[model samples]
Target chain A: MQFLSIFHEINGDLKVVEKELEKYVLTQEPELTLAAGHLLKAGGKRIRPAFALLAGKFYRYDFEKILPLAVALEIIHMASLVHDDVVDASMTRRGHPTVKAKWGNRVSLHAGDYLSAVALKLISQYQDKRVLKVLSRVTVEMCRGEIQQISASFDAEQNLRDYLYRIKRKTALLISASCELGAVVTEAPEKIVRALTRYGYHVGMAFQITDDILDMISDEKVLGKPIGGDLRQGIITLPVIYALKHSQEKEHLRELVTKQVKSEEEVQEIIRLIKDSGAIKYSFDMANIYLNKAKKELNRLPDVKTKKTFKKLTSFIGERSF
Target chain B: MQFLSIFHEINGDLKVVEKELEKYVLTQEPELTLAAGHLLKAGGKRIRPAFALLAGKFYRYDFEKILPLAVALEIIHMASLVHDDVVDASMTRRGHPTVKAKWGNRVSLHAGDYLSAVALKLISQYQDKRVLKVLSRVTVEMCRGEIQQISASFDAEQNLRDYLYRIKRKTALLISASCELGAVVTEAPEKIVRALTRYGYHVGMAFQITDDILDMISDEKVLGKPIGGDLRQGIITLPVIYALKHSQEKEHLRELVTKQVKSEEEVQEIIRLIKDSGAIKYSFDMANIYLNKAKKELNRLPDVKTKKTFKKLTSFIGERSF
Candidate 1:
């Protein structure tokens, strides 16, 4: 096998899996087909499915077994995005108009349901009962996360522990399940499956922490949406929470939250305060901590090029726009 | 062995199932828990799940095997109700405030997601692959039916064939699957499974037809809601369709629909016209047809007391006023 570097050749298995996703997402609704198409075309990184395929390589990688899990995970992710658009009242996703903006909330909601139903249907193809149980539990956890987030909006004192738990349920659990179930479906060793699950949990925590930080600092052009949209909506994310704790301007920040800020200028001003208060850097440090932990989990795996690539991914997450 | 009069004996089993339902409807959020509880406490007849358990007894009465499927079907039914309240923008369900009205549309949507997730999770417990496949497909069809109904709303010329298909997806498919899968989980023979499936389909169709007829003639005091709610929302049910086909005052009815009548007086007038035009009787006749069909399917079942109660249920559907 080639060494894990940018110089290494990409696996043909991933290419086939990607091709299957493109085909699968195409065959959804006909009336809302275009809206479902819009969601698929919105350009997710497909990171979860990638983790699934990589984990699959450790086992007897049967395309039939691995592909359904990958597709199901991706579809679950897509459904969440559709509902996220509704929750955020977001007009665009990944630089394109969202289903809600294009077709209205009703259509978007139904499209999301259709996507979820399709995922559940696809997962039934697997004979492994444990895999189905994992998927079912993940879906429940994800919904509970969404519910928690909805109810917790604007609660400045919600604490880091609750925030972490929410994100773990919302983002990390599904991603962790992605890796673990990928191994289980492919019949990987129990040790490797457990290790990959740990890796996924930490990596996903890092990924979300980075995303939260990026929301406060990234360029709008690169982010494909306005920066600090989360803060504007009174979502007290990690960076905001950190800033609130340490800043001299805590009263002013709370005041701004109570009285909704309307303009992009005000939003940017808040973002500046958050960044200047060292909240973004603090968040970055926390993300790196998780990345380091994720890297350590891979030590349980054998000395292989794929393991190295997994390490590279951890590093990439840590260094991403630091 | 008791002959076919065993439907009422299911009350104890239903009470046991309802207690479990209360346990499952619990939530971390008090407001949502209470709102969902309102629907749960509205005291529905629990016909779908009861049918599943009763059918299960025909082979081997293992409530343990049947309980999950029964609860799952009811949860799915409740999820549909939550979403339907949002789509209809209604404020009440079964004489209590709906989740949408109490918690707003966002929470209502998420709560529906939570309910559906619970249903799917319970379903995943069964080791039988066939059961999983049937339940998942039924969910997909249910979502599709909702989409079709949303799109077809207020289309006065919408085909009767389309209407029947919509009811099949929205109501009958899950009910039929509950019976069929209940048998499958118990390892019941193919012929009994087929017969139970048919029984569920016919009963479900009759149920919807009764709902349509009751919309025209039942009192709000008895029905626990305003009569003509469907017509008020511009849902052209079987009675309305029949009235439009045969009534000389069809143009007047269309004008009333366009007027968007809201007052109880206007609702009563529409109800009177529907009743006077023989549309109510026509709808009742249609319900009787399905009731007879359901009875015919029951004839294939073994001669037992539970089966007799099943027959009584068909007659009950035909004769029940509200």
Candidate 2:
């Protein structure tokens, strides 16, 4: 909510986008409508759509022209989340039952697919080929990253570079594409587009790192999910990677993670090891590095009110606690 | 093999599509390449691409221009199959282990999604918004149909219309889209495009009915899967619907289908009831009606050499023993 406050000036446009998203979610099929509504009702930060709208502000801002693209990006994000929960066998998301949990994996899979197809259909209405190309490429990369993550799971041998590459594709690439697409759809200057894209990349990296930190340290009530959920599922995030590389108890940590931990006590023990290993500080420093790079890229953009909003968004990303 | 040989005149073009499909399947990720390769290697008739190319022949045909569309359609088909197997929990397709069977559901899900994204990216190379629009709409419909099928599984209350609508979206729409896309991409006259699309729709309906019939009666070795596969999975196909409607043992049949049949004998008993119900003849006649309709639509096109080939393809669909 604090992050979304940055869009106070454009609240009406955001409301329109929210309505458009709701409109798109209505399908002829009842089950699909229910599944989509469930996810939409769970609510999100709508960060991708916000980035798209913010990027459009740098150029000529027409809310109607950008509304479809914004809605499409949000749908894509929601679609991915539905499938991600299935892949992770997760029970809850953001304090709510997942689509997979509520409707079952089979329904969740098709629902996710339906939402993605809807996104493509909506985006196809636009004439810009580049926007479609970017979104398509990013979608493919995101899937590739997911496949990589699945294959790499429980493999304690993975290095920092592998982790970074996976996160770049899984998280950063889509956010960057969201920023790039906003500019491309609005036909912003090439320089401004490139700068926003870079800014998005850095911000996304920082954003994911911050998320990893939250997964480690945040309370379940605040985080909206159990802490250390990623580690429990054998998903190695930045803190885990750093702890594995630099901690003296690396072998013990690997042993605990490489095999399934059957008890809650074991999971807590692993979390304690990760925290005491100095990995949290290292991860925060890495996120700060990306945040600085993001701020630098924002300096390249022209002097506009939206530029300040972009910077504020980046800070919000950096300072977000949960 | 006999059906594919009908493409003798366009053999070179078909080969180009095959090679392009192979090229697209190659990926930097080993597991994805392997999973996609497994599905591709366990081949189908390539009927959808053939429909696309045949539709292309009505206009000034360019093999190169039509290849990507053909390949994209095939990839979309393959991707759906990967996901479908997961949904049905099927063990084999075409005498080979399914992606889900070999790689687990998680990998299969992501692999299916990756292939879909690749199809979109490849199609985006063409500037035709109509092609994107058709593909996107068809993909959405296909997902909707799957969700409907799942939600309506073992539904004794489903009518003939419900069955037809499901198959139209699940099987026929893509085939229809293939033919329509081929004509659209080749810049065929609107009259010819509409005719081919109608032809594809009828043929696709017939194809799915034939497939449903085959699922009931075909030999395991010949069909590359166990008979009664769809019934076991509670997928209420045309034959099953017909059987439930006309069989004197309708109550018993419904009882057997609505509950989990735990043994081979129970499945075989249900098959016997369906066969004795004269559902086989009803299904074949229903398929022939569509085949005749498809032939009628083909006659609306110009009497090009490809017209004869299209007629032969329709007969092959109707007459396929396996």
lDDT of 1 by residue, A141-181 (tens): 88888777766776777889888978898899888998898
Worst 10 residues of 1 chain B by lDDT: B87-96
lDDT of 2 by residue, A173-263 (tens): 8889888888888889999899989988998889898998999889899888788788766788888888887788889888888865435
lDDT of 2 by residue, B62-99 (tens): 77788889999999999988776553222233234443
Q: How many Å off is the CA of A298 in candidate 1?
A: 1.0
Pairs with backbone N, CA or C atoms under 3 Å apart (clashes), candidate 2: none
Considering every candidate listed, which one attains the maximal DockQ?
A: 2
Q: Candidate 2's error at A302, in angstroms?
A: 1.7
Q: What's the number of clashes in each of the models? A: 8, 0
Sorted into a CAPRI-style docking class, model 1 comes out as acceptable
Whose TM-score is greatest here?
2
